[model samples]
Target: MRITAAVLEQIDTQTVPHRITLEQIELDDPRDDEVLVRVISCGVCGTDRGCLHGVEPYPTPGVLGHEAAGVVEAVGRNVTRVHNGDRVMIGFPFCGRCYRCLRGEQRYCEKNRDLTFSGYRLDGSGGMRRRNGEELAGRFFQQSSWATHTVALEQQLARVPDSIELEMAGPYGCSISTGAGTVLNELRPEPGTSLAVFGAGNVGLAAVMAARLTSVEHIIVIDKVPERLALARELGATHTFHASSDTVEEIKELTRHRLDYAIEATNGANLVADAVAALGMRGTCAVVGGSSPSAKVTLKHADLLGHGKRLIGVMGGGGQTPAFLESLMALQGQGRFPLEKLVRFYDFADVNRAIDDSDAGITIKPILRMPA
Candidate 1:
């Protein structure tokens, strides 16, 4: 079956529309441990924006999206985790046998960077591109979900509850997971802890929502956008500060001159300095934003030494866990997380526009739905 998809023929190039209908590219029917998914909903994430503008998988004519959710159309012989027809949200494929994966942190899988970005299949033949041999890189993050159908390792895809709408839950694959995992897995803030999160975009908001579930009493969010600041307050931030306003002093006053942990969601280098300065003793600041390669961030050494501040860089919210995803789904169901509200729907045809809107900060989360 041939399908239409958003194709980027070159890095740093605009998404090009394909008029020549291309048929589906098949894998050798999965590798005994693989499952095939008919992707119904895929989110245009920040990573896709970065990649589209030339970051990971530098070469172009690429299939960019990684946050995909769909039904399991088929599976290989050794695929015990899921059978055909099961709905799933694909995660980053982890080796499962690596030290990091053994520790239940698949996002940090020893080979995660290369595995997700290499633009080649483990065996070398990509399952994308035109049947005529144009060669589009598939299996990006092990699932080039920008297309209608995607092949995934059974290990990376998570089966979701039938009660939840798969389309609305797509952001959980990356954006939500990154935010929730940082607080739930890394910070684990105790009651009365003061935490400051810089940047109130999708990832920052996810952290805000997840932070509300924790005992952390004061959640302060900072962003340049006034609308995002207001949204953060609605999402669960105890205090909100506009980056355009008096930031550092306001944060100091909000924390009464001390802080517990600072989650840096902005790529700005100076905000890192501010987060470190706002911390009390034994503080941790986790950097979770996706910035361009040219972006450089610098922090002071004194801030680290004087207060025992720890800076940790996180990936995929410390790797998606069933428990975390389930909890996020449950929260969304309860109307607590309200992730759906963050999304603006776009027809599959406007994927390029949606990406543009996302970069322009016009849409919180742009979900591209296949034509009905």
Candidate 2:
């Protein structure tokens, strides 16, 4: 089938910077274990920016959207999870046979890297190509959803209820789910505990909202943006802070040096140190930010061992999909999660503009609506 897609032609350089253009391309039919979807909407995430800026390397002429919601157009003979006309969101790509997956931890699938960033399917053949016979990297996260249509593995599909709006369901696949899952699944902070979340972007804000649902007493949100801090307060943060040299001190003082948990959610701003510095003894910090593949963090041995402070990395929310996505939708429907406050819609053609706004921190979550 012929489809329209945003193709990243080149990385941002001194001369030609951030060049992405819409073009007509050819998409292959779904494989035996895949399903074809007509994307209704997709979210622009930090990972997309990382790829565009060369922080992450994806092949040129590739589609780069992983957080997507759509209606199933067709299903291959072997697909049984979704069918025609069913509304669904694409989740992380995982090899079902991996040890972690067998243990119900699909988020840590062994082939996650290849399935997500390798551009080609595991068999080294992808479903995207140019009309002229050139191959395009279109299997990003198994659903390269930047296009009008995409082929996704049957296992990655999450059906959305009729009560949930399709536009509001896309981000649950990644950013939103990552933040919420870090709290609900990973941290699981106890009652009367305190949690400070650094960087009030979609992920941090989602952490704030999820914290409110818990019995955790103090939900402190930190960010450089005043509007984001204020919005975090409205989304159930008990306190908000503007990032500064004294931000750690403030968080320490607020919790009387007994901060129970902290989360780092910046887009490679390196706030992990600040999050750790504010923690009390035996406190745990969850880092969920997107960074360059080569980026690394340094931690002081004494600070960690002496205080028993633990730092952990979370990927795609540290839980199974579809079920977790469904739970988030239910919470959102109940007026609890309230993720809609952070969402701003854009036309698919204005994807670059949306990316620009996200980079500028003008939009917390940008959902691009595809043409019918």
Candidate 3:
């Protein structure tokens, strides 16, 4: 089938910049374990921008979206999880046979790197190509949903509740889930504990919202953006701080050097050390940010070993099951999780503009709505 897609012709750089182009592409039919979807909306995540700006590795002439929500169009012979016309949101792909997957840790699947960034399916086959039949990398996260239509593994989808708007469901596939899941599923902070979040971007703000649902006593947010800090306060943060050299000191002072938990969600700002430094004895810090492949962090040895502070990395918020996504949808429906406050919609044709706005911090979460 012919479909319209936003294709990244090449990686962007300081010397030579390239922008994603809208073009007509050919999409392959669903395979035995795949399902075809007509995407209604897709979120522009940090990972997508990382690839666009050459911070991450992804082959050129490829499609890039992963956070997609849409209606099912067709299903392959073996697919029984969903049917045509069913609403769904695409989630991270995992090889079901991996040891981690068997242990219910699909987010850490052995083939996660390949399934997400390899561009081609595990068998080296691709789902999209140029009009002239040139192969393009389109299987990003198994659902390269920047296009109007996408083919993805049936297992990588979660049903969207009827009460939730399709446009608001896409972020649950990645960013939102990453922040919220890190708290709800991984940390599960004890009652009356204090938690600090670094970087009040989409992910950090999501953490603030999730923390609101917990018994966390104090929620402190740190960011250089004043507007984001204010918004974080509105989203349930008990305290907000401007990112500065003394930010960690402020957190230490506020928590009396006994901060119970901290989350680092800065998109490659290298705030791990600060997050760890803000912790108290035996405190745990969850690092859930997207950074360059070569990026590394530095932490004081004593702050870790001496204080017994733990620094853990979380991917896509630990383990994202369909039920978890549904629960979030239910929360949104009940007005408990106001995801709408973070979103701003854009027409699919304005893809570049949406990216620009997100980069400029003019938009919190940008969702591109596909043409009807």
* Local distance difference test scores for all models: 0.78, 0.91, 0.93
Report the alpha-carbon TM-score of model 1 versus the true structure.
Answer: 0.92
Order by lDDT, highest first: 3, 2, 1
* Candidate 1 residue pairs in backbone clash: 9-61
Greater-TM-score candidate between 1 and 2: 2
Write one digit per residue (lDDT tens) for candidate 1, span 275-363: 77677777888888776656666777777887678888888788455557767887788777788768898877778788779888999
lDDT of 1 at 4: 57
Superposition TM-score, candidate 2 onto the true structure = 0.98
CA displacement after TM-score superposition, residue 57 of candidate 1 (Å): 3.4
Local error of candidate 3 at residue 177 (angstroms): 0.3
* TM-score for each of the candidates: 0.92, 0.98, 0.99
Tens digit per residue, CA lDDT, model 2, 1-372: 999999888878777787888989999999889999999999998888888888887888788999999999999999987889999999998889989999999999999999988888999998888889889899989889998999999998888877779878999999999999999999999999999999899999989889999999999999999999999999999999899999989998989999999999998897888889899999999989876657777877876999999999999888887788888888888888898999999999999999999999989999999998
Name model 1 segments beyond 4 Å from true.
13-28, 267-270
**Candidate 2 residue 67 C-alpha distance from true site, Å:** 1.0
Q: Given candidate 2, what's the lDDT at residue 281? A: 94
User: Can you rank all candidates by TM-score, best first?
Assistant: 3, 2, 1
When summed lDDT is taken over every stretch of 10 residues in candidate 3, the lowest stretch is: 318-327
Candidate achieving higher lDDT, 2 or 3: 3
